[model samples]
Target: GGGKPLAPKNANNAAKNSLRVADIGAGTGNLSIMLLERGCEVVAVEPNDAMREIGISRTKDKNIKWVRATGLESGLEDSGFDWVTFGSSFNVMDRSQALKESHRLLKPQGYFSCMWNHRDLNDPIQEVAEEVILELVPNYTRGVRREDQRPVIEQHKDLFDTIIYIEEDFYFHQNIETYIAAWKSVKNPYWDLETSEGQELFDKIAYQMRHKLPSEFDIKYTTRCWSAKARN
Candidate 1:
């Protein structure tokens, strides 16, 4: 038994009380919950069924609406939101199209933001993990998520202005089991996990994590963010 899923509050009321935000590709609603806790009325959009299901479950008690949609084509109303955000999901989208959609969703001068939490591969433990993956999956790539986002965001100067970028490093401590599970959730498009080589790579990583690492360890990460306001 849960309360009714959060619906969009009245426009004037939302504008008076808080910001209305569209969280595109809101995997598991992590960022949505954060926004909700900070008094924003959030609409969380996710295209994948499994991920959306988990997201709905996670935010059932929170006041956040979950929508089935993609970042490039979120089926939200025009000029209805004070902010549009993509949390670590922007790299998977066509940046140009996504920016257009975000601009369409934002109110006048509303903000648009995309951010990623990047693991510090240079960390001692992470370095070993990376070496293991590279040894097995020789073609492993970090993809666009690691690349600088300024050039692409700047490309859409017509849609947005006043680009603001920030980066900060932090550390998280977790058990070996939890860390391994986190790795499993990262589905790399190029990595053919059905192959025997893929299985071996995972098995080897798990073995190394269980044997080589301590029960609980600190992992370093940098949170990178880019934001801009609607041009018109």
Candidate 2:
């Protein structure tokens, strides 16, 4: 699936009220960069060395502290953050433990938000791409089932009284070259598919898709975001 840019919203509402913010599993600091641009004191927790390096290099001018830590053990002080965000990284951790840790680190009324840029399976091309990836990487875990969001929210209802959950579709325009480059950026299943056979399969799929394109293609994306606050 293509890595679509996050939509702008009232995120600053939470940021403005908070004195410090931390982005968990901040791969290459995409969301962290935005927070910095918004003038928030931001810290990024990323365990992967290479990914952290990329983020550090990208945000050289911005004031972003990078820490090598997982979701459950962020190595941050207790009640240290007023806002904590997980952009496209919530599914990678033990959700229950991560939620608990988030609650622990957040001060009273602090917000915990999670966002994901998912492919709209309803789109034909996206559906085909999903099928291709599934067949190619059968062992890969299907991260973040779409239907489970409501249940997750229910499980944490007591922790957060005021909840805002939303899913929206966004469209991205890209040419074949840009599309391929975007695809290569995806880790895990795509990165694992570095073998000759995998390359052949990806090339074949890209070629087939290119023939159907009219100089450019519209990639549909579904972005799901959930925000809640730690009750006092």
Candidate number achieving the greatest TM-score relative to the actual structure: 1
- Which lDDT values do the candidates have, in the order given? 0.83, 0.75
30 Cα displacement, candidate 1 (Å): 1.4
Clash pairs of candidate 2? none
Error of 2 at 73 (Å): 0.7
> Tens-digit lDDT track for model 1 on 89-180?
88887888889999999988888989988998779988877776777678889899899988988999999888989999999998989888
lDDT, residue 103, model 2? 89
Span of ten consecutive residues with least summed lDDT in model 1: 1-10
In TM-score terms, candidate 2 sits at 0.76
Cα RMSDs of all predictions? 6.1, 6.4
Model 1 TM: 0.86
lDDT of 2 by residue, 1-232 (tens): 2211223245556344434788999988888998877667788999888789989999997767899998789989888887889988887777878888898888788888888877777887666666655665566555564444556756877676567788898899978777665555455454435478767767765665566545677989888888887876
Extract clashing residue pairs from model 1. none
Q: Model 1, which residues run further than 4 Å from truth? A: 1-15, 191-204
